[model samples]
Target: MGIAELRAESKTASESTAALLRELVAHLGENRTQLREEWIRRITEGRLLTAMSKDEIFAEATSVYDSYVEALETRTLEALQAYAQNLSERIIPRGVETHEVVGIVLLLRDVLARSLFSKYHADSRLLNAVLDAYEPAANAIAITVAVGFVRERERIIRQQQEAIRELSTPVLQVRERLLILPIIGLIDPLRARQLTEQLLRGVRANRAKLVVIDITGVAAMDATVANHLVLTVEAARLLGARVIVTGLSPEIAQTLVNIGVDLGKMNTVGDLQGGIEEAERLLGYKVVPIAEPMPA
Candidate 1:
């Protein structure tokens, strides 16, 4: 065929695909009730969404079914993406996992594909054309939903991790230009790095001049984490903050020693109270003893 004839053929094919999709959407809408119920039944049989009660599952299924159909019909995913994010927020807190969310979408896709096959089986040519138009849209919709849920889940997970990091490594302002960080529990490289970050942020936020890090609650520390502690001290010094480390375990002290870390750099104290007192002293806070009279 000539170029003009080829162009006309392509336009006709595009319109024909759009018409097939419109018919597919209408058929799905007409059979929404039976198809959705069948999908729900399959979900129940598969033991998915067990975190939700039957009514909860049914309600969410209805919303998801409508969104799924809308996505396929419109060939757009913004509405479906928003719905998936909202659904993830609701269901994730109820212990719904990524696999469960993906599972139900695939199940719905399967159910709808089977229904389409049964509807168009008598006409082989039309069946092939319908399937050709439907499968790509169906796959795209499923990917959009699954991706939305995963992104939301990842965001929530990061939020929770930040909260945990704050709780685990607490940097408190003891006095003007003085802050204390009481680190408890095991210090892996990740936690140690988080500790460094929290301390640095606190120092900058408080404009802290002297910092006391108490690791009494810490059971042990490896050489790598000890290096992180040393690096933190160096970082603080560069930021115009002096670091005092307290509650050093024997193993950790030895690890620091073996690593040839300069004790002058770390400025170790025996305990949290001593570290605070030293911090206060360094900040020019003097303690005046007050004596009580025997008789007034």
Candidate 2:
């Protein structure tokens, strides 16, 4: 037989031996009483048919007893060898169903002789069924692991995104009703465009009355960035939101002043607190302590 056949035979032998052992264990319960009884019945029936002389009868009975003993011993040896092989290979020898044993036996039979591939393709149906039984359990485990990983990844990504957003700009809260967006990163055309959309949406949704854009964080700006800022301010105005320019460092202030950027139409403040106080003044509210005056 080919190597494949030999291997197949070996597996079949292992499986069969295991199955036989299970059957034998069940059969031999009660101190082998069942086996003993069956043997006794067979022997008794055979002895009754011996109607020959005493010597002939004695010889015939002895021969039958010896044959039975030898057969039992041979079977015992084969079973012991099968058990040992199974232990070495880590095969669970007991509790196997008939269908499993049948499958293994079929495989073993195929291995004993070499033939064309089409003549005896190993029937995959049995193995397939076994795999099918395990599919749902395996898939459940895989999905659980995948979902856990995805949740963990999403959490990590959200944390990182929050950090980036925070570092992108300094938020100036105004009177608990308005916010001044002071962008720090480069206000290139793309960023300016995105900021415009965000601010407009925020102002309308929040019903903001004022937005003081502090430009001190801006390191440098080209004409395009400058023009985008102008357009952003105009859009906020159209949405019924007032705009204040603040945090104008000396250098930027000088540049805007020299460039003749129009400041006559815009309200400007020097710092964030100053801007908020100005907005609160315009709204006719004063933040003061509610305590009686003390006299010495």
Candidate 3:
């Protein structure tokens, strides 16, 4: 065919596809009750959405069914995408897994497909055309819901992780003129920055003469993190608090050396107990042992 002929043919096929989808959408709407009930039955049998009560499942299933039909009628996914994300937010905290979310959607697709087949089955050509129109939309709808759900889950996880990082980085006042900051786990650049801020605030607030930073739980550090550690020590010094670093792992010590960190300027100790003793010595406190009494 000539280019103009081919272009005209393509437009005609596109129009036909849209028309078929419209007809299929109307049939689904007319049979919405039976089809949605069938979908819910299958979901129950599959043990999907088990975290939810039957009433909760029915309410959510109704919303999802309506949204799915609406997306078909509109031929766009923006509304459906928003609804899926909202649904995910509501249900994820109820312990819904990704497989469960995806499973229910596929069940819905199957329920609707069987309905379409039953309605359009008398004429083979007509049935084929309707199926052709329905398959692409169904696949796209599934993908939209799946992607939205995953993105929302990732967002929640990141938010929780941020909260945990803030909670874990607290600088604690141990006694008069003494503070201890025990850092553990992995430290990103952002967390390293937080360490400096927390240390500075604690030293000033406590008017601490000595601060012990025990990094026994930390396994290693990169050059950037080593620099951040050095900066945190200097910030405490500028605030008139002498900093003692204990639990210097071999790997972290090498990272500091590689970063050109001058260990001579930083007071180092072997363990938390040794660092506390050294801090007490600098504050002119006598180390006297008092044994605990036995229980009567």
Give the whole-model CA lDDT for all candidates, comma-separated. 0.86, 0.50, 0.85
Clashing pairs in 3: none
RMSD of 3: 8.8
Pairs that collide in candidate 1 are none
Worst 10 residues of 1 by lDDT: 287-296
TM-score of each: 0.85, 0.39, 0.72
Cα displacement (angstroms), candidate 3, residue 120, comes to 0.8
Weakest ten-residue segment in model 2 by summed lDDT: 108-117
Model 1 scores what on Cα lDDT?
0.86
TM-score of model number 1: 0.85
Top model number, TM-score: 1
On lDDT, the candidate that comes out on top is: 1
RMSD of 1: 6.9
Candidate 1, residues 142-209, lDDT tens digits: the string is: 88788888999899999998899779888899798899899998888989888898889999999998
State the local distance difference test value for candidate 2: 0.50
